[model samples]
Target: MARIQLNNIQKRWGAIWGVRDVNLDIADEEFVVFLGPSGCGKTTTMRMIAGLEEPSEGEIVMDSEVMNEIDARDRDVAMVFQGYALYPNMTIYENIRFPLRMRGVPKEQHDTLIKRAAGLVELTDYLDRKPSALSGGQRQRAALARAIVRQPHVFLMDEPLSNLDAKLRQHMRVQIKHIQRELKITTVYVTHDQIEAMTLADRIVIMDKGAIQQIGTPDEIYNDPANTFVANFIGAPPMNLIAGVMEQGTFTAPGVRVDGLPAKHDGKVTLGVRPEDCTVTADGGHLSGSVYGVEPTGDMTYLTIKVGDKLIEVKAHRDYRADLNSDASVGFDPKRIYIFDTASGQRLR
Candidate 1:
């Protein structure tokens, strides 16, 4: 419904910067997610776009119109909060129709609007039910339906799925993705959940401490992180960060030696290896450590190794689950290794 452009967007809370120098272009009908850890300014950035919070600097334009002077209600955006925010006394029908009614849409149009929204979210079954009678997933759907009925130019969601249990959250995510795709409305979602960001977003904006760290597709973020923070933040079990000194093209850590692969640093540098990228070797690997434990996650197994004082974790397929408690040799793929400046935490090619 709208293409969003933010240029040098800044939000300052007194001396503290909530977000700074953020420039992003979100295509019309694209699903974009602002993702990072808590206090990373994701929500603040979303609020600025929604006009709920004013930016200290920069420009926000929606569908070619500058929005600096526009109020939140006039911005034609609908926001879904994490709390659901459903009216306890209102039935599902009333809740869904509340937005349209507030705008005094014709009485004849309310039923058609409500039905279409309920159908999109598959909440027609519970239209007569109160918020008290609905399940967590159902309640979330009701809230989503309410947002849809308004037909806003852009949709803003701030961790809307965080409160649900694991199973329901997964189901709801699929449903939300489907609904968003079908409607083709511009959407901005904010969450710290990497899985949610990967699955739902067409492009993900990774933020940290009020600055935009990286913005890319899921594969781009996962396979090629911009810096150490992004490498550590986006993974499920997370990437292993080991401190090592590069000497004569060999990397040596306190307890492990990574041979063959060379580095350009005589000074200490941090090496990052994704769990899945670490391979188990029979004869000799780059590093050897005592097996701390094994975590079986249905299809894949995670092996935690104790190398001197440091713990390294690696992911192996189900076949390696039997190697638990045994001594292990690990090797990182050369192409998969990420090197970061020890002092700056910036990526070093």
Candidate 2:
């Protein structure tokens, strides 16, 4: 519903920075996610956009209009919070209708708007119940209904699903994505969970140390991480990084060695490969290690191999089994390996 822009946005407290030199363009009706660890400034950036926090520098713009001087309520942006920010004393219907009433919508239109919002979020049955009467998922749905009733130009959600159980989170993720597509509103979601970012975002903005690390589709960022931080951060098992030395067209590390590699950069480097890319063998392969641990997760098994000072995670098939402390070897798929500069943590071709 609106195109959002953040230009060189920075926020600081005296000497410490919260968000630094952030520049991003959110397309009209696009679903964008701000992803990072706690204290990484993703929440701060979203807060700046919602007018909850004032930026120490730069501008926040919506639909070609600068929003720095605008009040949060006047900006026509609805925020759904992680804690569900609902009035505990009010019924679900009243909570959903709160926004409409605050914005001075006619009393007659409130019922229709509230009903539509509740129905969209599957909260119509619970509308007569107070928030305390509902489960966490139901409470979250009511919160979403509250924001939806406003029909704001921009939808800002800060980890709205974090409070739910794993199963409930999955269910709500689908609902949130469906609702956004149906409404076609420009939504900016913030979360520390990469799975949420990868699944829900049209494009993901990854931040670390109060700076944007990389911005791309889930596939791009996963397949081609800009740095080691992103490589390790994106995956559930995360990419395995082994310290090595690169010279000429070959790379060498403890228990691992590869040759005929692309000749781009040389010297000490770190090799990155996703857990799925590694195949575990009993004896010998590209690398050798000892089985540190084995975890069976129903559908698949996770093999933790200890190679000298490094631990490599291997996502093996479900039936795969290995004894702890047993000898193991790992074959790295040459085509899938990533090389990063050891000092800078930046990718090297």
Best candidate per TM-score, number?
Answer: 2
Per-candidate clashes come to: 0, 0
- Residue pairs whose backbone atoms clash in candidate 2: none
Query: Global CA lDDT of candidate 2, please?
Result: 0.93
lDDT of each: 0.89, 0.93
Over 279-348, each residue of candidate 2 has an lDDT whose tens digit, in order, gives 9766568889889999999999999999888888999989999888988988889899999999999999
Candidate 1 structure, TM-score to reference = 0.95
Residue 30, candidate 1: C-alpha displacement in angstroms: 1.2
Report the alpha-carbon TM-score of model 2 versus the true structure: 0.98
